[model samples]
Target: MNNLDKVKKIVIEKPLKLDCGKTISNFPLAYETYGKLNEKKDNAILAFHALTGDQFVTGINPITNKNGWWSYLVGPDKPVDTNKFFVICANVIGGCIGSYGPNTIDPITKKKLATNFPVITINDMVNAQINLIDFFKIDKLFSVMGGSMGGMQVLQFVANFPNRTKTAIPIACTASHSAQNIALNELGRQAIMADVNWNKGDYLNSECSPDKGLSVARMAAHITYLSKKGLQEKFGRKLQERDDLKFSFDADFQIESYLRHQGSVFVDRFDANSYLYITRAMDYFDLVKQYNGNLSNAFKESKAKFFIISFTSDWLYPTSENKEIVIALNAAGANVGFIEINSDKGHDSFLLDVPEFLKSIKNFLDANYKIL
Candidate 1:
């Protein structure tokens, strides 16, 4: 974050009225790009990142010093094949990294926005990124793709700007946040607020953070990203570097240790307030409601090709939910494809090295790119 200025970004001089009834201008949308935009600029792909993801989609993230969140799928000769197409990814508004959010100091106030930042929605996030397209002077994008929260943006993008992209891939996402998911997100938000150090989202003013609460929230959310079967096979009742269980409350099971590690690392790179805000945005997402309860109507005007994908083990956003999108697209008479990949990796399957899933994406993009 100290080197945020090094990241690529564009300051939108045009005013963007957020769904929360607030207007903002001269805001930054931090982004990163890979490969080259061809002469026609038709080979560019706009990739949206999920919750906790940043502009780094592939290669080593300069901030985290780790591989990009979608490294497996976006590098040269990989599924997204950056070698053949230019890829652009941005840190969404209401996100912590470089983008305008709770951690960003308000230029006028000279203080962190914290809880004062306007509550943003998925629609607002997509609209902010549209500035990037205009900045690049791109007439249209070759493709738009993402998974989980990112996938949600993909659907919202195509629906909002039907003619802006040639193809759209929304993997392991839903048109509306299910009650169950909303509850899970609430649990995470509550965990953050419960921390005494949170101090009503003013922790930064006191030179402290709700790291403990944020860690617990991450641990809980990480479980939903993995399948039950995957957990059993990978961790199960295996002890963590011991022959017998500790008699105390310390992590005894390997699964417990894994989750704890996940939580700990997450708190280091992510902001608690950003987590709260983004989850709220996800819960408020209801494309169906926006279209008057007719999910098909959301895409009725979109001519972009859509490919919906789901994982066999993803109970978070199950095949059934994904099928709903496909069904809506079909009812709208849109050109769309659907695939329920066989994987034990749950909702995180799209981020992992699932050969079948990777192959499908490669084939879809390659075939479609040839058409262009």
Candidate 2:
């Protein structure tokens, strides 16, 4: 079998019993692996993907026919250094890319889940990943690293299975979803559901899917992923492919064109209903709540060395939020390091080519872990 076929073959059906009290039987989780897990399984690194990301972490994506999202940091000689560590990136539950999600058929109903899918949470996603790890027979992960929504998963994993991780890194994430963040996600959901073409979440069987609404939602969320300064630097009143402005509703600025392209391309590979479920899951995430509303208590049992990173311009989950994580780790008496990198890339900085971030990660791993 080819690489894609191998990946497909590894999918585990009925990964877990979701938090919603629903059993997702015969589910599939797509993942990609690099390097080999040593006999001791000490070289394994679990890399989680952010919202809109998939299992294609270090190599080209066969399905989308595009380059891997984080190839810059996870190559043969890069910071993740596939040559030394066994890296595994799995599509989170409620994800559309070969994973159980709203698009998955309900065996009992004999129909696609659509809007009938159970509401999932970050805890659910982390729990499913733990199952996968157990299936692989990995007693412990060398590290768990991620950014944004992925970072939230990292936090959830550490909180839920403190003994399973040797090191935990959560970059550009919050301990819980802020009210403002929840509002933003709710607005996006509203936009998608409001579209007449949505057909009350049954757009899959409709003549035309809710592309316009989904595109608008993507455009809005994409703005939060970028920094104001970055946007200004890249496209400050610049004309769109034309010297003269149309004065019409057409995309007049370069930023508008860029956002349009992002939205259009996103809808082609993503399911609108899946987007709703996953974003809602993120909005409902609160790691502290599980520990009696005390963030520090959540980490009290964690023995992993923690590295919490934040970008200066990431307003979505500002430096303040990362500091909150640091404070909790400190209170828990966990070995922790915190860094706020100077960057104008917003929450997307962790995924982008940031030299300082890469350097810090490399140095931290080198000093602490035995990289084979």
Q: Root-mean-square deviation of each candidate, in angstroms?
A: 0.8, 2.3
In Å, residue 315's CA in model 1 sits off its true spot by 0.4
Clashes of 1: 0
Cα displacement (Å) at residue 278, model 2: 0.6
Q: Rate the local accuracy (lDDT) of all candidates.
A: 0.93, 0.86
Best by TM-score: 1
- In model 1, the Cα lDDT at residue 275 comes to 97
Clashing residue pairs found in predicted model 1? none
TM-score of each: 0.99, 0.95
lDDT of 2 by residue, 1-372 (tens): 024344542445654677778776556777778888888888888999988888889777877777788887887899988888898888887887767778777777877788887899999988877767877899989999999998999999998999998999898999999998998898888889988898988877656889888998999999999999999998999998899989899999899999999999988877788889989999989888877889998888988999999999999999998899999889889889999999998889998899999999888877777632
Q: After superposition, how far is residue 181 of candidate 2 from its true place, in Å?
A: 0.9
lDDT of 1 by residue, 109-197 (tens): 88899999999999999999999998999989999999999999999999999989999999999999999999999999999999999
Residue 225 lDDT in model 1?
97
